[model samples]
Target: MARIAVIGAGTGAMAAAARLAVAGHRVTVYERSGTYGGSLGRYARDGFVFDTGPSLLHLPAVYRDLFVKTGKEPLERCVTLTQVDPASRHLFADGTAVSLPDASRAGVVAALDQALGEGAGTRWAQFLDRAGTAWDRSRRPLLEEPLRDDREVAARDPYPAPRRRRLLRPARQAATLAQIGAWELADPRLAALLDGYALSYGLDPRRAPAAAALLPYMEQTFGSWYVSGGMRELAGALYERCVLRRVEFVFGAEVVRVAEKDGRAAGVELADGTHADADHVVLGAQPGPELVPSQAWDATGTRSAGRAAAPGRFVVMLSLRGAREAGAVHRTVVHCEDGTGEQEAVFGGRIADVPTVTVSRPDDPSTRPDEAHEAVTLTATVAPHGPVDWTDPALRERFADVLTGRAALAVPGLRERILRAEVRTPAETAADTGAAGGSVPAPALAGAGGAFLRPGNRTALPGLYLAGGWSHPGGGPAHAGMSGALVAGLVVEGDGFRGSR
Candidate 1:
């Protein structure tokens, strides 16, 4: 059996380990953080629990597949499912409003019909139906593949070959989500839906992908659910599965570097300066010095030729006295009637306090005390380098000021209900997790080669591979899980969950 050393205990790393171990490889995982569950992981305050990242659970099957493929059943381990609300209420710049739902695309169309009127409903249906189809089409092939084969991806283009030929660069226009967003012209409604799509990326909808306009279809169409006891439970469950499968997890162990011999990964070096051998090394995140051993950050394929998304974040860990009806509790973005207008203001360098707000309620069993408790996270995209003049004191004051304002606008008396609050800045976020520029999630900007420059799963380094939010198929908790599994399949040379036999 080949041996492998998977770095980082995030979902991607965890999933990769499972697949590698089950494939008969002697796998050892090295986590940079003291705890596991990179993004979806959680921490507790005096009797309160806070999920560090991703609150809602979509694409449950991604988690299910990891266990099943590794000879385990996720359903036997975690919460089966709980659906969240489908209606995502949007308050537009022109006072236009609509709510998109999962059960009935009809409701969404109806709302659009009311807002846009007449033929709008038909267009709405046509859009989501195509979106649903897009989701179905990309699920297995793109999500599961290591993305080493770009030619294969191009073949799946929805536009027929002749139409593609007529368009000189049809692939460029639709190869990846970000490219779609950047290429969009001045169509306001499509822009709003695109903005809604980029919400996953914490990006402005105008620059978001038109293809991404399809993401909402899952929650609104498939129904989102809570994992019951925080999505971190998914991590804990995976850890347990690793134990059951005999996959070794070296926790609280920071890998100092990866070792390579004659161009192949020999193993990894720990912070303690100890060496561990492996037959293969799977590296992820916007290729960093630590990710590629024996190579400079700029020299390795994972690093030099990689495409990194933004890593900016604004977050609060609060103990809710009680969560209000709070919409469907799945995925929500409550707006200030002028929400999209407010978002435009933000991008242009103005804070609307509560132009829009999103909250994730984890199913942590002990999240609430005798009173029902839920975890709420509120964030908006900010300048990645952060406000130039946002001094420590100024930023601190601004954060509190912003939170207070957002709470009032989003939920009545929301500021009053907080039992505790912990705020983090971009620099602080990097300090907590060694993310680049506090870039917990990297920017998915398509490089100058149109869309062709976006890094594939395969890097120039022969023995190394990449995964996580920085890797292709990008972002969201579930996407990370699948990314990890994709690397495992490639490293071990398995047939992969993608492609027909």
Candidate 2:
């Protein structure tokens, strides 16, 4: 049996450790932090609980499969997974509101038509149909399998955009997501809806490829989910599963560098001036020369190309004195009026005057002290830490106020109802995640000349592999889990391992 050493206790790393252990490999995970879960963090004060990471989950089948493969107990047995009805409520700039049903195209269409206009639903339905086509074309190479060297197949945009004819101009198909919204959806409100999806994932809709349409298709088709306690419970469940598989974990054990023997990854050197030898290594953190001595990897050709300037999230956690209103929508998005200004500010290293905000108020009692009180979370995509000085008290308070003001649209008397407010910026994210500039990585896309694809799982080093949000197939819970699976596949079945059937 090969002794495998994994760097970091993040979701992806832990997932790989469990799988490798189940395969009869002796695996040990070293994490710098005192905990697991990486971005799936939780904060609690005065009996109020808040999920510091992703509030909702999409594509839960990834974790479901992991649980099944690792043990007999399915995911549901470990955590309560409930499909959120009216998946989300959208508050448009013009005071128009619509609540889309979960995983129902017909229901979403009807709701859009009722709120936006008669033709709005039909236009959106058609757009999603095209988006569905993109999902089908790219699902295999981009998601289901390990990233291949000949990326020509995955590099090409799979989105079958409708061709449009302009006066005295040759017929052209939409390239960017913005183009698809304008050319196909044909409504400012509809376009904003589409842009909201892109921004939530840290993608600039203006530059994101048309293939990004698959995001909404994925969410709307698979549906949004919520755990009974919070997303943190999911992490706890996975961590327990790993322990059950006999995977050893070392908390607060920081890996300083990847050790090499005869030019192959042999083990890891810890920050405490210690080393543990292994037959193979899986790196889940951000790759760098200090960690991996290999110099053959090119950051420019992978998702790390934009790591320095990637977008991040600004979160405001509110403890309200009043109980959640009956029939309150679980998730509500307050759309910004000026999409261009918001995009330019977020990407151009500035803060927008008014930014799009997502408000999550899950109908779960565990998050509050009692039914008389409620916990609410507001999140917005913003410039990463380098561009914005999130450390400044003035800046933090001002931005928190801005987000809270926008959230007032979703929560009645929001400012008055708040018993306490806590703010978390990219700076906090950097501290918790150890990611440079606190920049969050977006999921990999299949267009823009392969600019959006992440680095392959297999690296230049013979015995070293990459896993997690920063690696192949890119970020998000589902994609990160897939990264772990791919890393295990490559290690167990050798390089010829294509993917799980």
Candidate 3:
């Protein structure tokens, strides 16, 4: 059996460890923090709980596959995963509101038509149909399988944008997400809705490829899920599964470097001046040059070398004094008044005057002290820590106030109902995840000359592989799980392993 050394105790790392252990490989995970989950963090105060990271899970099939492969118990037995009905409520800047039904194309189309106009629903449906084509074309290469290095194949944008004729110019198809929204959707609200999806994932809609439509397609088709307690519970379940598989974990053992022997990854050197030898090494953290040697993985022409700066999330957790209103949607998005300004602020390293805010109010008793009290979270996509001073007290307070003001549109008397407020910024994210500039990685897209794709799972180093948000298939809960699966596949089945069937 090969001895495997994993770099972090993040979900991706643990997932790989469990699978490798099940394959009879002795695996040991080294984590810097005293916790298991990386971005899947939680915060509690006065019996109130909040998910400091992703509030919802999309494409849960990834985790389901992980559980099925690792153990006899299915994912449902480990964690109560429920589909959130009326997936989300959108409050437009013009005071128009619509609650879209979960995973129902007809229902979403009808709601959009009734709320916006007679043709709005049809337009959205058509856009989704086209988006489905993109999903079908890119799902295998961009998500299901290992990332291919062929630039021609990776650079191909799978979005089938319809050709549009112009009065003074030649016919052209939409390239960027913004182009698709303005030219094809033909409605400002629809454009804003599309932009919101892109921004939430740290993608700049203005520059993000039209193939990014697959994001909404994936969510609306597969549906959004919520764990019984919080997203952190999902992490706990996975960690438990790893433990059940006999995967050893070493908490607070920070890996400073990947040791090499005869030009192959030999083991890991810890920050405490210790080393653990392994036949294979898997990296589940950000593959920074400091951790992974430059010679092992040259970033010269790879996707890792030229990836754009990703945005970070600013969160405000509210402990309200009153109970949640009956029939309130679990998720509500308050659309920004100025989309252009918000995009500029996020992508251009500044703060917008008014930013789009997503408010989450999970109907779970575990998050609150009692039925008389409620736990609510408000989040916005903003510039990462390098550009914005998330450490400044004034900036944090001001941004929290702005988010609360925007969330007021979704929650009635939000400020008055708040018993306490806790703010989290990119600064906190940097501290928690150790991501440079607290930048959250976006999912890989198959467009923009392969500019949006991430580095492949395999590296120049024979026994070393990359997993997690910063690597192949890119970020998000499901994608990270996929990265772990890919890494395990490579280690267990050799490099010929394509992906899980």
Candidate 4:
């Protein structure tokens, strides 16, 4: 059996650890924090609970497969996974609101038509149909398999943009996500909706490739899910599954370096100056300068391609005294009135005067202190750590106020209902999760000179692989799980392993 040392006890690393253990590998996980979940963090105060990390789970099959492959119990048995009906409620800039039914293309189309204009629903449906082609075309190379050095195959835009013909205007295809939104969706609200999907993941629609349409397609097709408790419960289940598979975990043990021998990864050096030998190493977090001899930043440098900066999140956790009313959508997205300006501000190293906000209010009783109280979390995509100082309390409060005010549109009397409130900035996120400058990792996009393609799982150094949101296939909880699977498949099956079937 090969010995494996995994860095970071995050969901992805733990997922790989569990699978590797099941495959007869002696796996040991080292985490800098006392907890198992990395970005899946939780905050509790006065009997109220909130997930500081991602609030929802999309494409839950990623975890379902992990649970099934590692043990006899299905994912449902380990964690209660429920489809969030009316997947989301959107409050547009024009004050038009629509609640889309979960996993129902017809329902979504109908709802959009009912809320928007006559052809809004049809336009959205057509867009989704085209998006399906992008998903099918790129799913294998971009998501299902390890990234290849020759990105020519993956870099080629797969989004089938319809040819536009006009008098004296050459027929052409839409390349960027912004182009697709403007050319196909037509309606300003619909364009904002499309951009919102991309922006929510820290991607800028202005430059993100048309393949970015896959984000909404995946959600609309697979459906969004929520656990009985906060998303932290899902992380707990992964940790438990790894334990059941006999994987050893050492919490609060920070890995300081990846010791190399004979030009291959040999083991890990911990913060305490101790070392553990292993045949292979899997990095779940972006490695620091000490971990490798390379520069502090990867080949892409510390930031994303172009002048655009990495996006961060500004969160507001509210504890309300009132019980959640019946038939309330679990999630609501309040789109920014100035979508373009907001993107420019955030990416240009300034606070958005008006930022798109996502408000999550899960009805599950576990998050509240009985039915009398409710837990609400508000998230806004913002600029990552850099020239902007998220550490300034006044600045953070102002951003939080803007997001809270925007969320007020979704939840009536939201400001009045709040019994208490707490704020989480990218600065805290960076400190808690080992991500540089609290910059949340975005999903890999398809264009702009392969800007979206992340570093490959297999590094130049032998016996070392990467498995996390920052690696190939990119971010999001589901993608993180896929990274783990790919890493395990590569380690166990060798060079021939394309991916799991």
Candidate 5:
């Protein structure tokens, strides 16, 4: 049996550890923090609980497969998963509001038509049909399998843009989401609906490939789900599953560097000047410059390619005095009025004055001390750590106010109802999760000369692999879990392992 050492307790690393252990390998995980979940962080104060990481989970099938493969208990037995109907409520700049039903194209289209105008439903339905084509074309190469050397297949945009020609003008197809929104949808409100999806992931619609439409398609097709407690509960279940399989974990054990032997990864060195030897190593953290010897990681594909800058989230956690009323939506998105200005500000190293805000209010009573209390979370995409001085108390409060003010659009009297408030910035996120510059990696997209493609799971260094949001398939809980599966498959089945069966 190979002795496998996994660095960091991130979702992907833990997922790989569980599977490898179940496959008869002796696995040990070393995490720098006292907790197991990395970015799946949780905050609690005065009996109020908040999920600082992803509020909702999409594509839960990834985790379901992880549980089934690792143990006899299915995912449902470990955590209660519920589909959130009216998946999300959208507030447009034109003062139109619509709540889209979960995973129902007909319902979403009808809602759009009712809120936006006539013909809106038909146009959106047609667009989704086309988006399905992109989903089919890219799902396998992008999510199901490890990235290969031939970038042509994945690099080529899978989105089938319609060809349109004006009088005396040549026919053209859209390359970006913004272009598709303008040329295809041809409605500013519809354009905002599409752009909201991109901006939510910290991506600029003007540059993100049209293939990005797959994001909405994936959500609407598979459906959005929420755990009984919070996302932390899901992480806890995964951690418990790993422990049940005899996977050893050492928390608060910071890895100083990757130990090397005969030009291969031997194991890891701890910050306390200790070492653990292993035959294979899996990295879950972004390969910082000090992570491994410079020569070791110099030419490795495991190293991040330093892609274009992505925005980080500014979160405001509110503990309200009132009880959450019945029939409260799980998520609400307040879109910006000036989409261009918002995009330019965030992507140009500044936070927008009028940024889009997503407010999450789950009806679970466990999140609060009593039925008379409520827990609300507001998130807005902002410039990453370095670009923004989130450390400044005044600046942080100003941004928190902005988020709360915008969220008030969905939840009336939200500011006055707040009994207490807690703000989390990218700087705190970086400290908690170890993301470089506190920049959350955007979900992978197709285009920009394969710029959006994450580095391959296998690196130039022998016996070393990467598994996490920072690795192959890119960010999001689902993608991170998929990366773990791919890494385990490669380590056990060798380079021939494409993906799980």
Candidate 6:
């Protein structure tokens, strides 16, 4: 068995370690945070718990595979999955609203057709049909596996077998813009598609890649799911698996630099001056950590290196008197950012006079005496603007007001819903988390230059392999897990790892 060292104890790193350990490799995960969850870490203050990171859980099967491969049962440990109707809504600036559906979401399509037009439903159905095809073709190639060594994999295991019409079919040809424009409808459906895409690359539908055309169908058709509680459950589940496998987790240990020998990464040295060695090293490569080497940052300097990370929550955790939706664990209340103002500021990297909130409500059992409601998690995306004192007392209050104003734009008396509110900026996030500038899974998504630009899973340095968001397969939670699995696969197979199945 290989003595493997998986870096960063977050979702991506943990997933890689779990997959490797199950595969019979001796894996040890090193996490800088005292807690196991990366950005998925939870912040519980008083009686309320807030997900410090991502809220929604999509692509449930990717996570389920982790348990199944390890000989564990996800259903045994977690709550059953539920498909939410009105998966999300877009309240347009002109007061017209559009709702996105999932899995034969005929209702949403019907409702949308009224606002958009008579043929809107059929147009969406046609778009989804095509989107499904693209999703199948690119799922494994573009999203599941790393792209760096893609040609080699395609030459071998062309997943799904064309007969299955699998999304993970074998193929090539760089995913380009010309491809996405065909389906990116400009009406309400277009906005729905863009919102999902915005969750990843910050690219609006019109600007998003044609390869990403499947964005809507992925949620509406395949289904967007929710865990019993929040997405934190998935992270905790993975962490538990690591312990069960006897993997060591080293948290609160910040990595200072990646050591090199003869031009290869040899090991890592922590900020506390302790050194550790591994047969291999994989970076969770979550957002801020990528900028560590200084060399990791391209010519755009510190700012642009982190610019791609769309700013996330200024969160509000509410323990309401009652909830209308029970066991309905997932709901994202979308707030439109008008074309002229705050929305542009937040999306364009400018200071928003007001913030844009995407409220996430989790399942709560005690919201209404004997009844229950989806516990509420309100998150407003706010910019990290100029010259604010990192330690200033005034920043939180200022941003809270900013978020409150933005919330009023959509939900009236938004402040009344907040049992307690925490205004977290990028700087504050970096302070609590070791990740510099609160960069999560470090823009693992390669910008431009396509696949060649991202570092390969196997780095130039020997005994070092990259997993998580930073690796060739690119970013996103599930994508991170698959990337880590690929790294573990390589180490297990050794030179033959790059060979064939």
TM-score of 3: 0.98
- Report the CA-based lDDT of candidate 2 relative to the real structure: 0.91
lDDT of 5 by residue, 293-370 (tens): 555466544334455446788999999998887788999999989999999988888879898999999988889999
Clashes (backbone N, CA, C under 3 Å), per candidate, total: 16, 0, 0, 0, 0, 17
Reference-based lDDT, residue 33, model 3: 89
RMSD of each: 5.1, 1.2, 1.1, 1.8, 1.4, 6.8
Candidate 6's C-alpha runs over 4 A off are 75-80, 149-184, 192-196, 199-201, 204-207, 262-264, 286-312, 322-330, 340-344, 366-374, 384-395, 405-414, 441-454, 495-501
Model 6 per-residue lDDT tens digits across residues 277-379: 7556667644333423433332112333434543444565544434444333245444454433654565566555644456565554422223432235657
lDDT against the true structure, per candidate, is 0.60, 0.91, 0.91, 0.87, 0.88, 0.56
- Candidate 2: which stretches are off by over 4 Å? 299-303
TM-score per candidate, in order? Answer: 0.80, 0.98, 0.98, 0.97, 0.97, 0.79
lDDT of 2 at 500: 86
Pick out the ten consecutive residues of candidate 4 with the lowest summed lDDT.
295-304
Candidate 3 lDDT by residue in tens digits, 1-501: 999999887777887888999999999999998899999999998899999999899999999999999999999999999899999999999999999999999999999999999999999999999999999888888888887657466689999999999899999999999999999999999999999999999999999999999999998999999999999999999999999998999999989999988988999999989999999999998887778877765841244655545789999999999999999999999999899999998999999999999999999999999999999999999999988899999989999999999999999888999899999999998887888778898998998898888888888888999888888888999899999999999999988998877
TM-score of 2: 0.98
Q: Report clash pairs, candidate 4.
A: none
Off by over 4 Å in 1: 91-98, 114-120, 132-141, 149-193, 293-311, 322-330, 335-355, 361-365, 372-375, 385-393, 442-454, 494-501
Model 4 misplaced stretches (Cα beyond 4 Å): 295-309
> Can you give the lDDT of residue 137 in candidate 1?
65
Mark the regions of model 5 whose C-alpha exceeds 4 Å error after superposition.
Answer: 293-304
